[model samples]
Target: MDKDQQNRITYTVYCINAFAERYRLTAKQAFAYLDRFGGMAFLEDCYEAEHQLSIIDAVNDLTQVCRNQGGKL
Candidate 1:
């Protein structure tokens, strides 16, 4: 993959791990929750802005986005 693609993937994985930790979920669970609740799409669609924020802030955004989509945590 190109550098930009690789960077996006790396950032995505990092966010997934961070999101998992923040919500006390395993990575697989985190991915499933995100996939179900639209957090994954939020991360992809907003990657430019989201990547500029701290990982904590990014995960907070993920949580809110997921919660808004009916996620419990």
Candidate 2:
């Protein structure tokens, strides 16, 4: 993969793991929730800015994004 694509994947996985831990969910569960609730799209569209932030900050942003999209947890 290209460096930019690879970096995006790495950052995305990092965010998923951090999010999972923060929410006490498995990585798979986290992925599903994020994917279903629009968090994945938000992350992709905002990757350049999001990855510059700390993982906690990214997760917080994702949490809000998901909540706005109707995610319960």
Error of 2 at 47 (Å): 0.4
Residue runs of model 1 more than 4 Å from their true location after superposition: none
lDDT of every predicted structure (CA atoms):
0.94, 0.95
Error of 2 at 53 (Å): 0.5
The regions of model 2 sitting more than 4 angstroms off are: none
lDDT of 2 by residue, 1-73 (tens): 8999999999999999999999999999999999999999999999989999988899999999999999998
Best by lDDT: 2
Model 2: how far residue 73 lies from native, Å: 1.7
lDDT by residue (tens digit), candidate 1, 1-73: 8999999999999999999998788999999999999999998999999999999999999999999999998
Best by TM-score: 2
